[model samples]
Target: MQNIGKIVVVAAAALSLAACGQQAKTETAAPPSSAAPSSTAAPATQSKGRECTADDIKTTGKFGEVPTITIPDDCDPPKKLITKDLSEGTGEGAKAGQQLKMNYLLVTWSDKQKLDSSFDRGQTFDLQLGAGKVIPGWDQGLVGIKQGGRRLLIIPPDLAYGEGGNGMKPNETLVFVTDAVAVTAA
Candidate 1:
């Protein structure tokens, strides 16, 4: 019975390969379970494609059909920063070893929600930037802004969440209104 089963499998394999336009030199290699042979190799991926627009990004896009990702213009409430003469922090704005006191509000691109906030709570956090401790976007976004300056950051998922986005939801783009008020380096 086993031998019979093997023969049937081999026959199926040979037939599938032939259907795929693949030719086998040795009849012995024609097994029923053999993968279908293909005359054409898989298409190569393009290195550069059309440039992406704001519409292409999504916060819930990663949720797969279950959740929809959307980024609206009002995600962060469009507002130009008021001019402040504070010199942009230079030469390692926030010391690598230091902690920073910052006020921020993070919102999801889709159905904008206040995922997190520091100022809303009348509190501030001591963030250690570039310590692989904070989100990559935060580490990089907070780089040049001065301690007393406020800035807005539009972080793509690649820099913010990569693949698996914020807990519960898939990685999604985030918008932040951040103000740096202090930095303390030990």
Candidate 2:
């Protein structure tokens, strides 16, 4: 009878240890940041309680080159998605299910800092339009962009990463300057 009691205690202890190990593994397996910035750029000051406008963002540099984007110190971010064409393309516009090759620069609205740039890496990002592979903003905003066109997209948190912004603050907005390099229809 004593041996039976000892066996029961041992089984309970083993189950407890196994549960703890599973919990530790689950905690350590959290998803990694998706938009890890390559550059250690400084963060921008908080906005002055105003919404961001197109005038507050300035982009300079020729098409197909790395652009220099300037955001004002007091600039605030808007709540909706905004897409502005910097340079219009000459050919047919891109459609859904089409594969697109683009060079892009990404910046966080709250920090006004560059997060990533395909131009800096000297490679174009390839993705299919209207696909769920990317954020909702990119899937919606990149449609109808012509090949060789340059565009600026201001994405709100709902359209971006939402509460899990990864490398950025929670619910942070994003700014992107995208240059369409090539397109292949599906």
Top candidate by lDDT: 2
Alpha-carbon TM-score of each model against the true structure: 0.50, 0.73
- lDDT (0 to 1) per candidate: 0.41, 0.62
lDDT (C-alpha) at residue 13 in model 2: 26
* C-alpha RMSD in Å of predicted model 1 compared with the true structure: 21.2
Q: What is the lDDT of residue 12 in candidate 2?
A: 17
What would the per-residue lDDT of candidate 2 be over residues 1-186, giving only the tens digit for each residue?
A: 011001111211222332211233111101212233234433555658888787678998767989978777775688888898999886888888988877778777676777666677576666667655556677778888998899888888676655532344566677888899997787
In model 2, the worst 10-residue window by lDDT is: 1-10
Which window of 10 residues has the lowest lDDT sum in candidate 1? 1-10
* Candidate 1 segments exceeding 4 Å error: 1-92
| Candidate 1 residue lDDT tens string, 14-47 | 2343321123211111222233223343233343
Candidate 2 residues lying further than 4 Å off, grouped into runs, are: 1-49
